[model samples]
Target chain A: MRIGLIGTGNVATILGRKITAAGHEVVQVYGRSAIHAQQLAAELQAAYTTDMDHLDPHADLYIIAVADAAIASVAASLPLQDKLVVHTAGSVSKEVLKVASTRYGIFYPLQSLRKEMEQLPDIPLLIDANTPDDLALLRDLALSLSTQVGVASDEQRLKLHVAAVMVSNFTNHLYTLAERYCQAEGADFSLLHPLIVQVAERLQYMSPQDAQTGPAIRYDTPTIEKHMALLEQHGEMKELYAWFTKSIQKQAASGEL
Target chain B: MRIGLIGTGNVATILGRKITAAGHEVVQVYGRSAIHAQQLAAELQAAYTTDMDHLDPHADLYIIAVADAAIASVAASLPLQDKLVVHTAGSVSKEVLKVASTRYGIFYPLQSLRKEMEQLPDIPLLIDANTPDDLALLRDLALSLSTQVGVASDEQRLKLHVAAVMVSNFTNHLYTLAERYCQAEGADFSLLHPLIVQVAERLQYMSPQDAQTGPAIRYDTPTIEKHMALLEQHGEMKELYAWFTKSIQKQAASGEL
Candidate 1:
């Protein structure tokens, strides 16, 4: 399968490499930056282009792996007619690619990709298409790069995207706050690493509600009070702490946990 | 070391097994329930007693691994004098053991322990003692069970305890919310697992600030609004989503991440 990568960012670099490694030909790379496009194109042994018009029209798939905000403009500028064009975004709808091609689809890989990372994460791909043939093609392409693949609607994708944010992005922000709090208090932040990993590992065997522990889940008011007092100096952290504590207690009281 | 365990809960069961495996003598086990104490004592090949007064007074260390609320009462009831007494608590103060023994300390294993786990987690021990001798002894005991050990003050422990909640307990709650949302939307919750693990694995190489992704970090208001609209039915989750989204945006605006 010949592929045309429509960006030179982390997603494009990593996914382009993976697509090429899986015996698919990344025939063309397009980007706003000449150097980045050339670098990615050179690495993937593909032709480089900054203009959307120069994109290989005969490519089996055109993957618009650009930033979310740039997807619409890129899709609009592309001159492809009926060729399969897909965007790799979790939040954005597949209809965003409709302006570029008739046979548009989504090839959302639900993993955080980093250019610095040596190995690509186990990307559980979520494929969606306007038509059945395009859906099957996206699924086949996704299966080539990942063992896990599923079909989902635009609404389902958005819900999963929100869920992904809750589990990954918001959770990481909590970690950031914790690290900051640890550093401010002169405590070793690494002390919490094992506990962090344990919580994540527990999800494999148990529901998060069943796995919940600590002062908030148990409603140990005294400890919660102490924590609240400690975070009084940190406005954002204090609000976050209180919100989570109340939320946890409310959930526990609701007999959900 | 001759150790007397004062509880038969999850911490007691796992830590007792580790202590015995580390070549220390679990001299006695004490619990409110005779059956629980006897069961744990039998498993560890130690003596059992339901009465606090019948505790082994000559033991080198008395470990009160009970509920946080019961710590002060149990410590006060202990019949030890000069023997080292420690409570396995994150937020509780070492001063709680003041009535039990003069050589009071803390042996806080920072990982969440479960009886079902076949092997002990990489227990990062945070020790605090009134004296250097007791500190060394606690450190040695901790070292026997795990290589990770460090000294922390009561204030420091409280801060870390708060951080632990942020990273572990709060994170798990978010996972719970995500799972619930997935179930409601009829999406595969397993699709988010790899993304979840990827976010965790990124922490090994980068700080959470650098590891953060998704609409929240990007301050993508359109997607945020879409998510908010989708979560209208989930009262708690809706508030949580708004809070985290605002917090992430604020953090980003502050140039923290």
Candidate 2:
């Protein structure tokens, strides 16, 4: 399928290259920034355009990979008739693409993407459309890029997005805080890397609740008090530590596992 | 070196197998439960003992791998003299072992251990001792079991323990909550596995602060509000979402990165 990419940010660049590599022809690249559009288009071997009106109308599918806020305006500005249009934002609704074309859908890649990554990670694509035929077409297109693809309604997608934030964004925030704590205490942060990897790895084989082990779950008050004493100097981390400890204990007590 | 393991929990079972695999002699296994002591001793092909007075005094090192609360009692009961005694509790000080033997230290493995796991994950051993000679001896023993080993003071070890809880225990708790949310919302929790793995894998190449990307960091109020509305039914999750969002924004505003 001939694809027209409608953004040049990290998601756009990574998806553009991936789509091109998947044997789809990325016929045009569009971006508000001229230099980024030109550079990405050159890398993708596609035509470049800064104006939304110049999007290649001849392409079989147009993917709007712009920011979530800009998706509506970009969809409104695209000069396409009945061509299939999709946006890659997780939170945004698929209905926003209806302004760009008669047939619209979502092609959300549910993974963090960076343009500089040498190897592409496995991206689970969540897709939805206004019609069954359009959904089928989008699924076919999605399968070309990822093996892990699923059809989700707007409500389900939003829920998945919330879960994604908890697992990825919030989890990484804890890591950031822990690294900061390690730095402040003059301990080597890398010492915890193996533990980090093991915890994530164990989730594949066992439930996270089963994999949980620490003073928090055991309710080891002595250890907890010691840690609390150590964290006294760090205000934000101390608060978060207390919050997470309480949360874990509550969950354990509720027998939610 | 000859080793005696004084516990029959997950940590003791895994460490006993690992130390035996590392070509050291596990001379004896001791526990309050005779059945558990026998089972672990049978697995390691070592002698089993339920009586504290029956511990192998000839062993080079006596590793107390019991629970945190029982470490002091176990150490006080151990019948050893002038032998290296170490407890495997992260937050416990090496001084607790002073009651067990003239030589005392800590041999804390800074990773979660599960006896049922088919493959032994890399365990980073944190060792500390009362003397430089004992420290060197413990380091050699730790190096035999794991490639990643370090010497940490009691305060430093406790700090690392806190960080480990954040990265492993708390992170897994987040995953547990996310999986529960997915189940409640009728979304496949396994779909987020790739994202979880990638987020952890990227930590090796970049700092979590540098790798952060999400609505919280972007301070995208629209998405945040949408998520908050969806989380209304989940009281605990909603509160956590609000706290983490505020925390991430505060971190970003502080320009600590």
Candidate 3:
């Protein structure tokens, strides 16, 4: 299948490599930067273009792996001639592509991508197209690369984005906090990793509510009070402890904590 | 070894059962309530006691797995009589046991323990003691159950506790937040999980700053504006977006983002 690859960022570069490796031919590569487009296209032996108008729209499919904000405008500017266009953004609405053509959809891969990542999984592809034919085309395209494919609505994708924040962004903050707190105490943060890994794994079998441990959940008032004393310097952490304790107590009352 | 376990709470119950399974006898079970004590003692085939006088200093060792507030008083009151005594708390200073006995330490199992979670891997155990022999005894005891064991300072243990909060407690709260937001939008939260796991695995290889994705990290102003607009109702989320963006920007600037 011939592919019109959009953008030359990490996701675009990674997917470009993956798609080409899967025996699909990338006919054109577009990027906001001319040099980046040329660099990526050169690697894939494809045409490179900086201008949106230069996009051929002649390939079997057009993949938009650009920044989410640029998607709608880029789609609007592209002379697709009613070709199928897909944008890969978790929180962006599929309707963003509708302005360009009704034969558009979302082709989101549920993974963090980067230029240096050596091993990329045949990612779980979440596809949603406007027409049944387009859906079949996207699904068939996704099936060639990934075994896991599902149709997700905008609402479902947004919900997933929120969950992603919890486990990913917010969870990473915990590691940072641990590192900071350890540094403050002149301790090695690495010592706590085993504990971190175990607590994380426990969540596999148990719900977060049931797997919860520590001073907050137990209502260990003295220790809670002690931690609060130490956290006085970090107002955010102090507020977090207070709010979390109250939240857990409320959840406990509801048979959730 | 004959063991006297104080506080028949969930931790005590779990430890009692596991120790019993290890073929060691829990000679005495102490609880704040006589009924709870008797019930736990019956389960472990041990004698039950509510009074401190029955805390036989004759037992090979005493494990105090009680609440943080009660720990100081309970240990103070127990007829430790220089008997080996250790408290199973991550936050509390092991010095709390010094008043009760000359031979004491801490035996903190570095994993979240739920009531029904009967089996656990050899999660790294953190041990500390007031004397060499006590440390050896605790070390041998921990080694008997798990190969992963180490000694950490009280300050380090507290940092671990704080990290535990960020990962387990705070992460769980984020889940709750996502659920609330998704529910408000009629979104399916499950779709976000693979992304969450991806971010998590990414963190194992890269620092949080490097692993950071999404509009906030990408500096995609339009997408950020859209997400900000989406978060109009949640004032707290708005603040989170702004603060986290600022923080990530600084880290990204310094860390080659």
What docking grade does candidate 1 earn? medium
Which lDDT value does model 2 have at B81? 77
lDDT of 1 by residue, A67-181 (tens): 8888998889999889999999888999888888899989888877878776778889889999998888888889999999999888888888888888988898899888887
The digit string of per-residue lDDT tens for model 2 on B1-257 reads: 89989999999999998999999999999999999999999999999899987777789988999999999988888778788899998898888888778899999999988887888889999999999999999999899999999999888888899899889888999999999888888999999999999888888888898888889988789999999999999987998899899888988899663
Q: Give the best candidate by lDDT.
A: 2
DockQ for every model, please. 0.78, 0.86, 0.40
User: What lDDT tens digits, residue by residue, belong to model 3 across residues B74-158?
Assistant: 8888777778899888789999888888888988876666666646444557889988888999898888766668887787777
lDDT of 3 by residue, A1-257 (tens): 89999999888988888888888999999888889999999999999888876678579889999887788788888788678889988888999888777688988887667776767744677889888998998888888887778888886776566446555666666566556666666665655555555555555565556666667667778777777877777665666677667776776677532
In the order shown, the candidates' Cα RMSDs to the true structure are 1.8, 1.3, 4.0
True contacts kept of each: 0.80, 0.83, 0.46
Clashes of each: 0, 0, 1
Measured by DockQ, the strongest candidate is: 2
Q: Weakest 10 consecutive residues, lDDT, candidate 3 chain B?
A: B248-257
DockQ of 2: 0.86
Mark the 10 consecutive residues where model 3 chain A has the least summed lDDT: A195-204
